[model samples]
Target: MMSKENYEYAKTLYEKWGIDVEEVLGKLRNIPISIHCWQGDDIGGFEVNRQELSGGIDVTGNYPGKATTPEELRSDLEKALSLIPGQHRVNLHAIYAETDGEVVDRDEIEPKHFANWVNWAKEQGLGLDFNPTLFSHEKAEDGLTLSHPNKDIRDFWIRHTIASRKIAEYMGKELGSPTLTNVWIPDGYKDIPSDRLTPRKRLKESLDEVFSVEIDEKYNVDAVESKLFGIGSEAYVVGSHEFYMGYALKNNKLCLLDSGHYHPTEVISNKISSMLLYSDQLALHVSRPVRWDSDHVVILDDELREIGLEIVRNDAIDKVRIGLDFFDASINRVAAWTIGTRNMIKALLYAMLTPNEYLKQLQEEGNFTERLALMEELKTYPFGAIWDHYCDEMGVPVRENWLDEVKEYEETVLSKRK
Candidate 1:
């Protein structure tokens, strides 16, 4: 959290840099924010026992191993919305049920019930973020078998893609807003020296079909490509291979980049530039580091933190929609989310204050050291210290204390996990 005096000092520095704090703040104001929700063992569940939470098993059994009834889930969502400041909206990812090892159809759940939940949220001034996988939760052969050139599997994917688009359209009409559709296909191949060509063609065909239907004059479909390793004996294969973004670009779709999904060694700016070159809408999933796991922890400054924001600023891409795609089954769920959100917001503000012309000049001069110094200076600015600065200046609630509350909550959750 930034002290009021420190914030004033930082504002002075911004003025010194010939940067219009008001103009930069105005641009920052335009970004619309949302979050992803699920009601399952993966993310939308309670963490009572450490073993169950860490072992990927559901012990709390809070929501019957499925999403709670629409009404019940919406209650939790309303609570979440209350915690956020201003007219903050959420993108609810519907939970699908698997009965006797088989996927259940969306029709099994009453449409009226779902619509009622959407209406309730809308009445409370919240938005929806719909996930397509909710409708295509079929349990087919594992990736090892699906990797084979099987027409049945290929057709199944096509049908799933089409069905997902239809569901999004229906939800959009019901919610009376453009539905936020997030597509993360968990299909992949396992073995090495396998025929990647066939799977690639099938995947591309499915994506093309989705693009043809999902996007239009009203709704915007964002394709979130994740980088995952093998699932079992077979290595998972979707868009992990090289040139996957190029394929996505060719299809005329936007790319949602999960920060933790990439290999740690990959250059963030280069990836952002590539996505921009293809005219793809960039969506970010910010998370913390966990060895070989998408642990979705709170952002810490000691780690590779500054570089993440630097890439975003240097790229000068402000239209990017940032989602706090956090998953914390542990006890301090709200605290973890608050801390992560605060850190990310602070980082973004720091990036916004960066001089675009100075960055260009540094690039032209080929002085990497000077460019890094400027970034470091910006990071230390007190106005960039706490996101509450903007809220305070804007006459919103002073929220710097949320960070402290989050830190304490995280400590409690970790102690219980241990």
Candidate 2:
């Protein structure tokens, strides 16, 4: 654990760089990272006779402690949240609906299906974000959902997206915070298609219908996510970044940029400034992709740090909505949550501690050598000590102590799930 005197000394070190450590910690506390619920259950939703992870989605391992029921999933989430500092939100997919033994099709789902989730989030004092599950269904087996050539199939997805928005609206109203309804359809072709324009055209039309019913902005805000490619949709994706960017701009909706949704060489940290130039608000699905869109656990890597810098230095924290989106069943599920969540918090703090003004002055004055030198010098600052203090203040175990708690949780709660 970090001692108060040591934290004060580290604070004074940062103070020399003209950074207010205490103020940054206060700001960090308010920025909530919406943790995905799918991570707790390995994305195996509770829908009856659920289709195999299709439409480019695949869960690699059969982890023994995977949450089998709603009770187990929420319980696991509680354990993860306990270890993580800051009041975070929960992100849910449409397939995670609780139907009370009644079969609820994707299109027929309502806010009632998620009443229990809303109540639980309320109990935790957390907000809820939502996504429409467009894959893992017979309707989407052909590697298309909203962009299907068949009008019936496309209409089915449209109805489903509309229903998801309504459900999100209900959550926002009940919780008194606007729920972000993000739409990400797995609509594309496995092989190169001759008629690419037609699919995008159909997708635009379907999205128009899905967003036609104007839900109150206070209750629900809409966002469209784009993708580079998926396992099945390798050749062409109907909802490409360009397609969604144009749609989001023209329709006055928030644009979502998943870090792992683009080419591995491309980093979303650079795109944040460009997106904010046009859109007032943007949503981010932060995940680490090792090579492809393989939602790996997030860490305090270069891109994650750059993303934090982009948001903090530009003062776009309020404009951007941060959410986690990755599932790794190869390890303890709750620990995966804790590891990723803490790293995210760490990245933000690292960025917050940077002396943005001095760095900008160096760049503006064309002192490139010193700018580079100072940048490297800033890396060695005692940000870890500050982070430990933040964890202590939030009542979470500092450093590796959280891991022991997770191991204990695995023994008590998760081990009994099976």
Candidate 3:
């Protein structure tokens, strides 16, 4: 909640930061933006009316292309990339499709085709981000049987991690950029007590495979996973603490943290500090808080605005790769993408000028009571609102109407329970 005084003070700070609100708005008038468009159901659904913002879509799901032929995937990539303005970058997630509920092996795909895809991306001058999951698949059954005493399954897991690293090497060689790989395990506890110790051991072993595999010189992989707290059989009990991704960081692997995945009570600044202590690059997933649900809403919601700003002011900003991770069902994909991107940009701009040093100084100098007062004052700071206004002025559409839609959605859910 921004107060009048806080808002005015934020305005004064913005002027000090040399941010010409009017000039930035003018530059953004025609800048391109990027989005993720892997779900086929959402492709070509909504047309972009404004041309000022442009970027390439991230392909995540199966598309019409050669599973083994990079040229075929490249062709599909070109088609999707063509839809956006040329200035944007395209991040391709998994390229191989599942067959009869099994992921096709990357080896099945010709190496020449993979090279061709990279060459084509180079020709088009588009940036590339590759997800390691491109080489593997996880079935619901796999999640259930992860702790099973089957040597064959364990071998498969090892193979999956190694193959993913190989693909990263290939992409890094072709794209001339560090290969990006995010590890999100679908494995977790279901109903009944499982051998927690065993799963942790296996996960560590699989990660060990990642560390041993030799990748290209410039390619650096970010090992990312999440924590889920909710009901039902799929509810994950062994969250981030159990896997101990910090061990990877201790051993020099990049750690990417998702904001929504933390325990509800975890402190945001503390989490950011811990991540920075171990890794060089930070990846964050932005979302609004909803009861027991990881709703990927835009960032302006009160809870997200406060915590998100604190994160930016901290030292994490320099190393952060701020990416939008939103989930949508078959409907309203375009609206989801538009709103998600818009909110991310707005939050980032606000973070760029947050009084992080001021907050830190106050905390260092004062007792607990003094620190609390400073925090309370920081929360009401009008920096976010001013940034929002700047984004609006720059023609980056802020969906005030959509905020009402979210409220309506929340109300409907509450009413249904009643």
Best by lDDT: 2
The Cα error of candidate 1 at residue 322, in Å, is: 2.1
The digit string of per-residue lDDT tens for model 1 on 1-418 reads: 3377866676778877777777766766555456555522244321111111221112222312223334444544544444444444466543422233244443332233246546675698656565544222333334421222676665555555455555556556666666656666556645664666776676666566556653453654555455655343235465563535666566655566666566666534456655665564666656553554354555655432553455445454454656666565543444444456546655656666767677768979999998888877766676643356676665543665544644553355323331
What's the C-alpha lDDT at position 413 in model 1? 36
Which candidate number maximizes TM-score?
A: 2
Ten-residue region with minimum lDDT total, candidate 3: 46-55
User: What pairs collide in candidate 1?
Assistant: 91-129, 188-237, 189-237, 190-234, 190-235, 230-236
The root-mean-square deviation over C-alpha atoms between each candidate and the true structure, in angstroms, is 6.0, 0.9, 10.0
Q: What tens digits encode model 2's per-residue C-alpha lDDT throughout 88-141?
A: 899999999988888779999999999999999999899999999998898988
Q: lDDT, candidate 3, residue 375?
A: 58
lDDT of 1 at 85: 41
Please give the lDDT score at residue 345 for candidate 2.
85
Worst 10-residue lDDT window for candidate 1 reads 47-56
Question: Per-residue error at 334 for model 2, in Å?
Answer: 0.4
Q: What is the lDDT of candidate 1?
A: 0.52
Q: Which scores higher on TM-score, 1 or 2?
A: 2
